[model samples]
Each structure stands twice: as structure tokens, then as C-alpha cells.
Target chain A: MPEKTVTDERLLELLASEFTFEQGFALLVSAYKQRLYWHIRRIVITHEDADDALQNTFVKVYKGIAHFEGKSKLFTWMYRIATNEALSLVQQRSKHAAGTLDGNNSAALLKADPWFEGNETQLLLLNAIAGLPEKQRLVFNLRYYDEMPYEEISELLGTSVGALKASFHHAAKKIEQSIRAI
Target chain B: MSKNTGQELEELSPLLRQMREKGDGLEVPHDYFDDFDKNLKQRLTERGVRRHALRQIPVAVKRRIWPGLLVIAASLALVLGAVRHFNTGNEPAELAVLELSADDITAYITENAADFEPEQLAVLEETPDAGNQSPAPEAGKATPEKEEIPVEAVEEIIDEMTDEELAELF
Candidate 1:
């Protein structure tokens, strides 16, 4: 027999009710965990960090679900939280590596990470992407990799669509330059 | 594709275009998401238990506890007040000596000379008004005679007292 799939609206309604919150959250986690994990993994560049950020994102969603006004799609709100957690982890890693030999090379860390499975070309691409500034890298990843629309990206990031377009353009140019130099 | 992105991609070099097409090269272990979901559910359950514990204080328990809590709090406040009162009562002389400057002591003694023991009044009488100004004699009041100590001499006496001597006096 085919199991009934719950809609996001139904899930939100259940989550808002005290009796069904646990069941609603479990369903929510199962539905979105993979998408959210991949999104976080791309930003943080490590599976473990992504795992931590994913869990943190869900925990935040669970806690904040009651206050959710449903102004935006539930997934979009979760993606925003996941993005913040991933970026916060990256910022922490940058600060931790500031004085070390690693310096600001997130690509080097990604290469050394056992979970990273990129080939030489992919590594070069990653290295190029890593060299872009943080916002540009995010813009590029969301647009190019996730294939998210600029309007959606703008909503998640609170940046103007025009600004995101410019950022993605600059990010692509910089990645091209970096890849050519390599 | 958006008009802007289509134009941007058209302008990109073939290698750059291929890179963008190739996507971010990342992978996860087999059954990683399954394991992650299980662990997350476990954590959420734990969190739910904790949150439930915090908010599930029973109405009956709260009703019974409030008056007891209020009593404990009031008792604590009274104990604290009594301790403060006792401390202030026990340290009156020390606080008076430490807080009042020599001139203030002389003025206070002169104003209320009838209230003190003769020995306490004599201590004020011997310690000169270090400022060299005498309190004015009121028309109906008897002026306690002011003994003037040179300002330099008063400063020297204060400077000569060790911390131990000052503490002992207090």
C-alpha cells in the first residue's frame, strides 16, 4: 500500500498544534533533510560540518516552528537557516585558520577532508569557487549549482535581484580567472 | 534560464561553462541521510523531553508550591534584612569613626555635646579641627573650644599611620 504523503501546509498545521508537533517535525525532517544537507554541504565544504549545520537547522526549525507565520514557503525558511548556519561555520573556520599555515584556503581543507570526492578538474573548479568572496561564492553556488532562481535567492539572502545578478557575474568571472591561472 | 544568466553563460569561456555545468563535486556516504534522520529524530525527542519537562509543571503542583515558595522567599528576605540590621548595629562606632572626617566629628560633637560620654567628647576635643576653621558659637549655645592642629602636622600624622594602625583604630 502507498503511504500518504503530508503536504507542507498540512505539516505546518500539525506542527502548530501541540498534539501533532512531534509527528509533524519528523515528517518535515524526512522530507527536506537531503536537500538541506546538500545545500549546507556545498557551502561549508565538508560532510561533518554540513551534518552539524543540518541538525542545527532542524533544531532551529523545531523551536521556531510555532512562531512561523507561513509568510514564505517552509522550505525557504529552513534553507535560510541552513545557509546562515553553514556561513557561520565557514566564518568560524576562517577565524580559526587566520594565523595558521592553512591561512584562508577553504579549498585546501576541502581537499584534505576524507568525505570530499571531487576529481582533479572538480577540485580546480572548487578551488576557483573558493577564491571568490563569500557572498559571490554563495550567489554562484545557489544559482549555478542549486539552479535556484534569482528572485528566490534574493528572498533567502535578503539581497536585491539586481545585486545577486551582479554578484553571480563577478563570481563567474573570478572563477574563470582563477581556473585559467591554475 | 533568466535572460541575464543566459547572456552571462553565453559570454563564459567553454572551460568555465563546463565547470558551471559540472556542478559542485561533493558526495556523501551510503545511507548517510537515513542515519542523519534517525539521529536527528533522537535529538528532537530528547529536546522535546527537555522542553516538555520545563513546561509541564502541573497546575496542582504549581498551586501547592506557590504559597510555599512565597513563604520561603519572604523568610529569606526577612533573614537578609535581620542580618543587615545586625551588621549595621554592630559596626556603628567603626562606621562613625571611618566615615566622619576630624572636622565633621568636631562639629557633630559641638552641636550635640550633651549626648556623648565625657571620654568620647574628650576624644573629639583633643583632635583639632584640621581645616583651621572654628564652628560659630550659637547665641544660646555653649561653644566647645576648638584646638587647632597645623595642616602640615595633621597630614604628617595621617601619613605616619600604617595600614595596621588605621585598621586597628577602625
Candidate 2:
């Protein structure tokens, strides 16, 4: 056991030692379990898939923890792993479900086009966001929905803040145009 | 350039202001995070199971892995056991004659039926236990295990040796 108090940071320090793999691993599971689950839940949008993806994420993290050289914070590393697992789950679920990877809500949008008739701004925003590539969609989601700063988005996506800012700018401009067109 | 701060900021920041003001996308339900946390904990548990199973195997045993590991394990147990027979350190002097010449081995088995059991000697003529990653086991069962036999002896006496003898000894 570590002589120091076992905060997450201190536990990380202990886990860095090969001698503390089990203790460190248990600590990791307990510490970030909830945060990771919620993060995955937002993307996959179903309890069953979220459950499966969450498990896969933890499994991946456990297998990959030793490879985590601590270049980033523990939560950031966990988030990255969770992100990959969630996106992969999304892709696989899309193949078997009514949704497609690129267009999960397209059918609903098409069907509800009449309902959103009064909400011209929403339609336009959707159009502009839909126009973006995958990476841009991710950047927009982090910046817009999560209200995250460029730095947090950068850490999560492993991109530079400068690049993320530029991406956000483009995304906003497109949304503006989409709304204007509506 | 001539515009006031209010007008400039309003026009430039229309999307940011309109996009639900950052903190207003959707208020999460009280149960939202709770369910997520439950699912996450369950996933962590499953991961623990897989990692625990991996940890149960000894490092040394996992090192020399092969496809036929279970069978190889059983055969190794029997072979090491037989090897321990001579290696016991307190054997009678006559029993220590496990290292005799081929002629002496056969003759001793033939003559000393009661004392020098031919069964033990016969094991010498049986096929090898089939070590992995070699061409030796390809020798048919009849070719005999001359793995312990000297290559010079095989070259001298057994010109009509089976493919197994040729493969194992030569």
C-alpha cells in the first residue's frame, strides 16, 4: 500500500508500479466507472448498447492500462478509450439496426420535416451540422453540446486547440448558413 | 469598424448565442447519470473477470505455449516421471544399466526375463513422445524412437531403416 493518502492522483502514482496492478486496477474501475458510462451513453443512445460498449471500454482499458504511459491525465486516457469503444459500437450497431453510421437521424428528420416547419432555425442548424465531416461533427458536439473549451476538446480528441478552434469556427459558419438558407 | 461593441458582438456571435447558450442543451434527468453509473460498474466487473482469468495462468507455463498444450502437458508428466526412475539416486547397480548399447540392451532384455524386465527396455524401441516443431514425429509408428541412439550406429547397421528411423536418427 502507498504510504500517501489514496487520492486518484496518488493511486495513479502507485499503479504506475507493476507491483500494484491489482490494487491500481480496482481503484481505476471504482474511480471512473460512472463518468465513462455516462459519456458512452450520450453517443450510443440505448441502454443495452451503452451497457455493452461500456463493458468493452473497461475491458479495453484494463488490457491497455499498462500501455498508458501517463502522457495525459488518467481521465483523458480513459475518455479516449471510451470514445473509441463507443464509436465502434455505434458503427457495429448501425450495421445491424435501422440506423446507418452516417445518418442515424436522417429518416426521423425526413419524416418530421413537416413538424420542424415552424422551427426554421433548428432545420438550418441541422443542415449545417449534417454538412460537416465526422471529425467536425465531433468537434461541434464537444464545443456546442458539452460547452467544452477548445483545450478540453483537444485533450479528448488528441488534436491541437488551434485545430479545434478552426474546426469549431467552420462548424458555426456552416450552421449559420444552414439557418440562413432555411 | 465604426460599429458599437453591442452590435458587433451580436452579429458575430449569433450562432453561439442561439445554440442554447452553452449550458442549456438539455437538463439531464436525475436518473440519467444514475443508470449510466450502474451500467459502467457492471462493465468494469466483466473486465475484471477477463483480466482475472488471464492472471491465473503462471508466467512460466504461458511462455512455452503450443496448440497441443494439454496433450503435451500429460505426456511431459509421464516422461519426466519415467526419467525420475533412474534419477532417484538410490537405485540398485544393475538397474542403472539403462544406458547400455543396442545389442546389450536387446540381449539383456531377452536373457534376463525375470529380473531385467523387457517392458522397460521395450519402451526404448517405442515411438518418441513427439516433441513439437520438428520433423521427427512424421516417422511412422513402426520406425521406432532412436532419438537416444547414436547417429553413427544408425549409419553403421540400419541401412534399410524406415523413414521414421531416417527422420529421427539420421
Candidate 3:
């Protein structure tokens, strides 16, 4: 999946001093839409919600670009934002489903649904991941689904490498527990 | 602990190999990545379009650059105005009083005389019509009613104060 679009040269040039928020914004959306959407989907578990959250994330990035300090990588920043969006969605769902259901219960609910057409391993993985706590769930998705390194995840989440390693360790244990249960 | 230190563990390899398999329960259609790529690129393009739309917003009213510039300009203007006002406060008429004292005034008057009466001397600075340059008044009849230094008084002072004396005084 080695895909490179506008080089930093053209990207910067297209985004040079003349960049009206228009071209730069368009280029950014073109570059990141799908990656962000899938990242959101992996966490949030609904295509429609993922779509909405993705659009909202892009809009947020578009509006906030002026404040972008460029100290971190753009993708890392974007991944952070997308991660936030997904977590926020989950938080909202948590609020709605609060005492009635926790993440594991909700995962069970979604898992039990007959309409789920996903492959068995994916369902198993999702079920196992769903059984994990929210932070651990996000860590697992980033490490496993998005195939992101702890270093990048650390940068995005502003956590220390040691803490992330611990988190990933705990998450892997939980997911393995779920898989073994399956 | 599932946190295997070495890649020697068979778990990760089996899982990855399993994920690659069609029946392993993660069978994304062949088009999944393609769709993901397309969707992502589309999102990125949408973002680009949004940025383009945002750029279309006129920059004249932008707060980041223009407002800051306006504030700087206003600050400079205020500073300039203050400097000018303080400079005007130090103008000649207002400043002249600072240079005057009773001794300087008496010295200016004692060295010369052109028959100015005591009344005229009393009203020397009040001579409203004496120093009228538009028309010459009678030599001694002109009242000291305006800001006028009489020509005869000037002449007498010039005569009494020789060029050397003037130089020495200066």
C-alpha cells in the first residue's frame, strides 16, 4: 500500500503563500478522507456514523488549519483528531447507553445481532476488542487494525512510550483472552 | 502476558497469516483496501475543496493578519500623535516664557531709547497699532497697543550697542 500523492514540494507549493484556504483544504481532504473514515469506522462500528464523524473531522481540520503549528506530522495530527472524533462518538454513545450498558455489553449486543455480515474472525476480533475498556480498545484498533506503531500513537495521543507499551500490552492480553474464549 | 518481547512468538505470525486467509473471519472483499483508498482520497479531496472554499473568504477582513496590522497602525498613529502634541506644547510662544526673566527684560530696555513715553513703555507689549507694517504711523503718536517693537527704539538700541558691544553681549 505504498501510495504517495503530492510530494512535500508540490504539496507545499500548492499550499504556498498564495494558498487561499481553498486549495490547501481541498488537497488535505483528498489526501486523508478514506484513511480517517476507516480509522473512525474501526472504532465507532457504524458506517453511517463513521461517515458523519469523518466529514465533521475534516471540517474541523479545515477550520483549525490556521492554528496548525506544524511541529508534528500532519497525518499524526489528523490521526489524533480522527481519534478524538471517534472517541467523542463513543463517549456520546456511552452517555446514551450509560447505566443500561457498558462497552462489553454493547459489544455483546452488536455481536448478537443477526444482521452482522462480517467475517467470523473480524467479528471475533471486534467482540474481543469490544470487551476491552475504551482506551485499550482504541489502542488495540490503532495497533492492530490501523497497523500504527506505538511511537506514532504516542505522538498522536501525547502519551509516553512506556505507558503506550503498557496499554498495548494490556490490550493484547484482553484481545487474546477474548480470542481464547471464542 | 501477550506482550512477547521477541518476534519469535508464533502468535503474531499466525494472526497475520490468518488475517490474510479468506476463511479466517476477516475476509474483506478484494475491493476493501481499494475502496478505503478511494474513500480516503475522496475525503482528502473534500477537505481540499473545503480549504479552497475557506480561502475564498476575503482576506481583507481576516483577523489574523489584517486586524493585527490595524492594531499596529493604530498604535503607531497614537504614538505619532502624542509626539506631535508634546512637540506643539513646546512651541515657540509657549517656550519663550521659559527664556524670559526680569533681568533680561530690564537689560533689553535700558540700552536703548527713542523717546518712548512712560505710558508707551508701560504698554509696550500692548501696542496694538504701533507696529503696523501696512502703513507708517506718525513717529511718536503711535500708541503702544499691539505687539510692535518701534523702529526708532530699534535704531537707538543699534546705535548705543556698538558692533563690538553687541558681539560681546551675544
Candidate 4:
């Protein structure tokens, strides 16, 4: 049988009830895990790191969901968590690779990733995006890849729409320049 | 925030439009998403066990643990006092515990069975002779007598408890 769609309101209700919490959590994971995985994958640049960040994101959500007062959309709240986890993983990885010979080379990491099916040009674009500053990289991914609205992006990132637009513009320009140089 | 009209990309950078056409080119292992929640369930369960293990003693159990120890301590003190009163010579107090028969000890415990309590019974049920049993609380149900410990205080205790301390707690 086809499953009935669970709305965010219904999800929150299910989560609030102790008896139905696991059921609601399952539905929540089924709903957002793929979307979140791709979003995290874009930032962390590898399946392994993305998986780690995604798991941590869900764990955080489980711990903090009770405090979520429904001030923002549930998707936005979860996206914020996924973004933070992805960035934290990147930071930790960079710290680990600081003095290593291989270093935290995203391009090399992407090429080595068994699941990355990109051609040379696609690889170059990903590499270019990876090279952008953290804020610019995040802005570009949410805008260019996910096609998330500027308003939603702003809400998730706690940045102004104008600043996000500007960051996206600079990110796109830098990525284009990087790809052109190669 | 405005809708992500495609026009923004063209005005921002033509190269980005072309790159989008090339796609992100990411893939997952076969059935990755299908198994993701199952794997996540396992992780969550493991986490639940760890957190539950940390809160091994409920507030009721905390209040009760000391009473069991006191009963044992008081019984030993009374036994020593009786031994000292009877044996004027320095025969040593250790011989009193040694002198008692298995039946005598069993009868004493049977007489005082009311003092053993459910929490101590739970510990004995879990470990017969191992002397170390899990101190996991009674299925996490709070009775009226449960004195709720603040979560911060529980966290503080969790941080300070070593393996030996945790074992002894059970």
C-alpha cells in the first residue's frame, strides 16, 4: 500500500507524543535523509564525511527537537543542522590534515571517491566550488546546486538576503575563474 | 528573499548556467537510502543504551542504595559488638563472620528480607554470583516517591564516574 504523506504539523504532533515518537522519527528520516545527504555531500565533498555529518545532524535533531518551538519551518531547522555538521566535519578534517603530506585536498578527495561520477569538467566545477571561501561556498551550493530560495537560505544561514545574493555572485565569479584557469 | 528565478544565474555568471547543465555528478551505493534509516536506527539504539547506562541509577534507586548498605553495615556492627561482649580475650572480630553457619546466615537474611528491597533484589536477580550486576533503573518508570535529580546534576555525575565507581553503583 502507498503510504499517506505526513505533513510537518502531523510530524511534530507525532514526535510530541512519547508513544508515536519512533514512528514519527522514521517518517522524518525517510522524508529528509536523501535531500539532506545530497546537501551535506556538496559541502563535505565525500560520501564518508557526508555520511558522518548526516548521522551527527540527525542525532542533534533528536536531542534538540523538543526545544524547537516551530518558529521556523522544520526543513529549515534541519537544513541549518546539516549545514553546521557538514562545516564542522570540514573544519575537523582540515585540522587533522594541517601538517600531513596529502593535506585536505578536496579535488583529490573527490576524484578518489568511488561514488563521484563526474567527468573532468564536472570535477573542475566541484573543485572550483570547494576552493571558494566557506561562506561563499555555502551560498553557492544552496543557490546553484539546491536552488534553495534566497529567503529560505537566509533563514537557514542567519544571513540577510542581500548579503547572500552578493556572496553567491562572488562565489560564482570565483568558481568560473578557477575553472577557466585550469 | 525572492524566488530562485533562473534569470539570477544568467545575470550572475553565464559559466554557472553551463556548469549546472553538467550536473553535480554525485551518486550513492545501491540501496544506500533504503538502508540509511535502518543504519540510523541502530546508531540511535546504541546511543540510547549509552545514555541509559549513564543514568543507571534513578532517583528512587539513589535514595534506596544507601539504605541497603546501611543495613549491611549496621548488621556487621551489631555482630562485632556481640562478639566483643562475649569474647573478653582478643580473639579478633573476623572470627565472628567465620563462625556463623550457612543456615544461620540464610535464616538471618530471611528474617530481614523486608529490608532487602526491590532495587537490591533487581541487582541480585541480574547477577547470581558475579557480584557485579547492571544498575539500570526499573524500566525508567518514576514512582511518586522518586526525587527527580536535575539533568545538569546527572550530567555532572556522569562525567565524574569511573568504571569502578559505575560498577560499585550497580
Candidate 5:
């Protein structure tokens, strides 16, 4: 027999109910894990950080499930949480680096990472992106890599669509300048 | 790239266009997502069990503890109420007096006048003394003197005043 599929509403209903909560949550994790992992990976710039952030995001979602008001799409809400967790991890890493003699360079870290398959050109592009301010970097990544629409990105970041567009434009200009310098 | 200043990079620069075409180059271990759910479930289960253990107190202990907790809560409430009562001094008693009827006030004054100061008794006695006498000649029939106001009516006006107004009056 074919596996049964559940709608997001039905899944949420099951999650809220005592009998089916665990199974519903497991289904929810499986559905979004890969997408969320990549989204996090793009921001934090490493698989390990992405993994930690992803786990933290899921744990938070599980704990806060009862408070989920269903005002937004489940994925949008989860994306917001994932984004926060990723940014928080980056903030921690930045703090740690600021304390050390050698500041933590994510570009160098990415280049050294065995899992990264990008060539020299890709590395240059990534380094250029890494030079961006946090908000601009996020705007660039979500726009360039994820191809997320400005409206959805606006909802996710609580930023205006016009501001997001401006950030992306500035980010692109900066990246081009960085790439030329490289 | 330097030659193309002010031109749109997406259109002018092949590298910029290529970078856009070629997405972020991140990878994961083979079949990572396949086992990710199982691993997450294990962690969640372990966490759930840990949380459950923390939440699970012995019913016998709870039964014993509840009476002690209730006693403590009652003691706290009593302490707080006494503190509030003392803090407000005689305001509550005055409010209670305001709620009493004219007959009740007369009876209270008759019983408790000995306990009160002469000045306090004079304030209480002024109401009935004025009511028994005829109205003053200069006074309009429509507007009674403040002394001619019935004790009940005076109390009603005081009762209508908010706490701030009452505080301001005192």
C-alpha cells in the first residue's frame, strides 16, 4: 500500500493532540529537514554549525508547538526559527573569534572544509558574500541562492520588500567590487 | 570588471552572471537526511524521558507536600492582609460606617459613644440633633444647610466618592 499523506493543517491538528503528537512531529521533521539544513548551512557557512542550528530549531519547535498560533504557514514559522538559530550561532562564533588573536574567518573555514566542492571562482564569490554585513548577507543569500521572492523574504525577516531590494543591490555591488579586487 | 563601472554587473560581467547561475556550493555526507529523522527522534525521545522524569514527583510526596504548601500559602495571605489592614489604618472602618444605615449609625453611636473621643461623638451626634430641629429661617426650602443634610445622605455622597476623592477630602 502507498504511504498516506497529511495536509499541514491535519498534521498540526495531530501534533496538538496527545495521541498522535510524536508521530506528527516526526513527520514534520522529515518533511522540512533538508530544506532547513541547506538554508541554515548557507548562513552559518559550515555543515557542523548547520547541524547544530537545525537540531536547536527542531527542539525549540517541539517545545513551543503548543503556542503555535498558526498565523503564518508552518514552514514560514519554522524558517524564521531556523534563521534565528543560525544567526545566533554565527553571533557566538563571531564573539569567540573577537576574543582570540586570530579572528575566525568563515571564508577560510569554508575553503578548508572538505565538503565544499566550489572551485576558485565559486570561492571568490563566497568570500565576496562573506564580506557583506549580516542583514545584507542574508538578503543576498535568500535572494541569490534560495531564489526566495521579496514578499516572502520580507515576511520571513520582518523587513520591508523595498529595503530588501536595496540591500540586495548593495550586496551585489560590494560582492562585485570584492571579486574584482580578488 | 573595472572597465564596466556603472553598468549592471548581472548583464555586463560574465562572472557575476555565472555566480548567480551557479548556486552556493555546499554538500553533506551521503544519505544524511535519510537517517536524520531517526537521530532526531532518538534525541527527542531521550529529552522527553528526561523531562518526564523531572516532572514526575511521587504521589505520596505530593499528597504530603500539598498540605504544607496550603498552610504556607494561607499564612502568607494572612500576613499580607494584616499588613494591608494596618497600612490603611482606620479607612476600612470608616468605609464600613459609610455603608451603615442612619438607624444603624444611631445604634452604633449609642453603644460606642463612650469608646470615642468627645470630638468624634460630637461629629456623630450633630446629624440627629439638626434633623429633629426646624429648618433655619435664612435657608431656602430646596437647599438644606450642610448640617441639615441627613446622615444617610452624607454617607451616600461619601460612598459615591472614589478612593482618590475620599483621600483628597480627608
Candidate 6:
């Protein structure tokens, strides 16, 4: 089912005014920071990278809140921002590393990462999932890991539901085949 | 996560279902979230101070400049009005003209003929015995040109001066 609308009118009103802006913004960050952090962490695949992206996202949200027209849920709008920031960080890092965020590199990083609690099997699955193409990888993670609904993913990614489903399906099949070969 | 039931995941792919059963391996440090808002608050406060400082600059500049600008504008208006008031009537020029004897006027016209219109020359020609050159009887000794006018030309020219024209001369 689609997520219920989460726009709080009082929060928006407080954000719109200069006097109550910080209070509203604090509440906003408290509510969404954990979710945003995990989502960015999934894309950027590092605690540090995710933290950077999350902070930048909140700064942007703070600056842009007055202009928000409430056409989409606040969570969806923020998710889109977080997604872009995380993807941008990935692209930047890939450029520096000569596009070496492949399955082997991701697996190595995951193994070294102290925050990652997964064993060998989980690491192998994550490596296979990371090996998928960028769009498929994002679709797969958001659907498989985050369990975001198709409707909400459609809103966040601006992709048709059918296209997202196809991407996710292909991604899952590829990961399965990669893991089976291993 | 609530929407994805065990049966649902199994239908999608058994491998994904197995992976789903094992939680995603990511974790944060203990009590990481406890300090997140506090750290973010510090960063935001710094940023907010910077933004507030930026927003104050133009307003401060306007405040500092406006009073001086208004004074300059008023000074310019006053100077322009004084110039206009002084220039409105050529009082000094009219007074100099009135004080001249008719003979001086005729002589000045003759000497600076290129400066006057032909109509002024015609008016000069109509002066009775304008050719006559005699000083006024009551006037003290005048310049050589003043000697050229008879007393009648001086009286006639004086009589032609309207009251408003005389007032303007004063």
C-alpha cells in the first residue's frame, strides 16, 4: 500500500516563519534523519559517505523549505534529494577510483568496514547486488532492502512502476546468477 | 518492510527470500543517533549565523547611506531653487539698462550694433532728434556718449517704462 501523506501543516507553517523556523527544522531532522541516513548509506555504501550526504541533504532542505509547494509528501521530496546527493557522491568517488566500485571492490570494502555485521554469504549477496547497473542497483536496493512501495519509489525516482519493476526483476536475477556461480 | 511478507518474498525469488530472512548487515555505532541532532544543531547554528550576517549587510548599507543621500538631494533642490529664483528676472541687467541715459543707450546701440536686432535699430531711428547729441540739464557731467542725447529722449524713454517693468528693475 502507498504510504499515507506525512505533511504536517503546523510544521510547514512554523518553517515558513522566521521566528519558529529552527524549532520546526529541528523536529523535521529528528523525524527523518535516521531514515534518510540509511537510504543514503545504502547508495553510497559507507557510513562516512552517508553522513556527509545526509548533512548536505538537510542543509538543502533547510534552505528550500520555504519554496516547497507540498505537491508531494515531504518525505518523498527529501528522499529524492538524499538519493541525488548519494548518487553524486558515488559518481565522484568512482571517477577518483577509475570506476572501481565493482563487486570485488564493494566486497572488499564491506569486509573491511567495521560497521558491516554481515558474514560471508551476506557479503557475497551484497557484492552481487552492487554489481548490477546503476539504475537496477538503485531500484533493487530501494525495493529489496528498504522495502519501499512501488508507488513511493515511482514518486521518488520519477520512473514508471512497470519500468521499476522490470529493473528490480532483472537486478534480482543477475544477483542470483552471480551468487549461484560463486 | 511491513508490506513484504515471507510468502511474498518467496514468490519473488527464493534466494532474495533467504537474504531477506537475514537482516541487512548495516549498523551504526552505539548511541550514534543520540548525538546526531546535537551535532547537526551545531552545524546549523553556524550556518544560520553566516546566513543572518549575509542578510544584514545590504540593510546595514542602506541605513548608513540613506540619511546622507536625503541631505544631498535636499541640498541639490535648494541650490537649484536659489539659482532659478535669482535668474527668474534679469533684475541686475534691467537695473543697469534703466540707469543708463538715453544718449548712452543710443551710443551703446551704435557701438554694439551687431548685438541688437533690426527692430531695435528701427526703434532707435524713431527717437526725435536722435541724431542730436546734448547732455541733460539736471544730470551731472556724463560720459562722452551721454552728451549725445537731448533731455527729451531721456524723458520719453523713462515715460515708456511701465510700472511693472520699473518694479522689476528695482
Per-candidate TM-score against the hidden true structure = 0.60, 0.47, 0.52, 0.62, 0.58, 0.61
lDDT tens string, model 2, B95-153?
Answer: 33334445554454456445433544454456332222134555555644432444443
Name the candidate, 1 or 2, with the larger lDDT value: 1
Q: What DockQ values do the models have?
A: 0.12, 0.04, 0.04, 0.16, 0.11, 0.12
Worst lDDT run of 10 residues, candidate 6 chain A, spans A1-10
Question: Please, what are the lDDT tens digits per residue for candidate 1 over residues B1-170?
Answer: 46544446777655666766665568788888769778887877777733211123334334544787899999999999999988875663433354445665455547655655676555545755554565566699875554444555344443544555445455
lDDT of 6 by residue, A67-119 (tens): 56666777888888998998898888889878757797787778777889988
Q: Candidate 5, which segments miss by more than 4 Å at Cα? A: A1-6, A99-104, B1-14, B49-170
Clashing pairs in 2: none
Clashing pairs in 5: none
Best by DockQ: 4
What is residue B63's positional error in candidate 6, in angstroms? 41
**Error at A18, model 1, angstroms:** 1.8
Cα-based lDDT at residue B57, candidate 4: 28
- Give Cα distance to truth, residue B34, candidate 6, Å: 1.4
Between prediction 2 and prediction 4, the one with superior lDDT is 4
In candidate 5, residue B121 scores what lDDT? 57
For model 3 the local lDDT of residue A134 reads 69
Lowest lDDT 10-residue stretch of candidate 4 chain B: B49-58
TM-score of predicted chain A against the true chain A, for each candidate: 0.89, 0.66, 0.82, 0.92, 0.89, 0.91
TM-score of 4: 0.62
Cα error of candidate 3 at position B121, Å: 91
Query: Over all chains combined, what TM-score does candidate 5 have?
Result: 0.58
Q: For model 3, how many clashes? A: 35
Fnat, 2 decimals, each candidate? 0.33, 0.08, 0.07, 0.44, 0.29, 0.31
Report how large a share of the reference interface contacts model 2 reproduces. Answer: 0.08
Q: For candidate 6, what is the DockQ-based docking class?
A: incorrect
lDDT values for all models: 0.70, 0.56, 0.58, 0.71, 0.69, 0.72
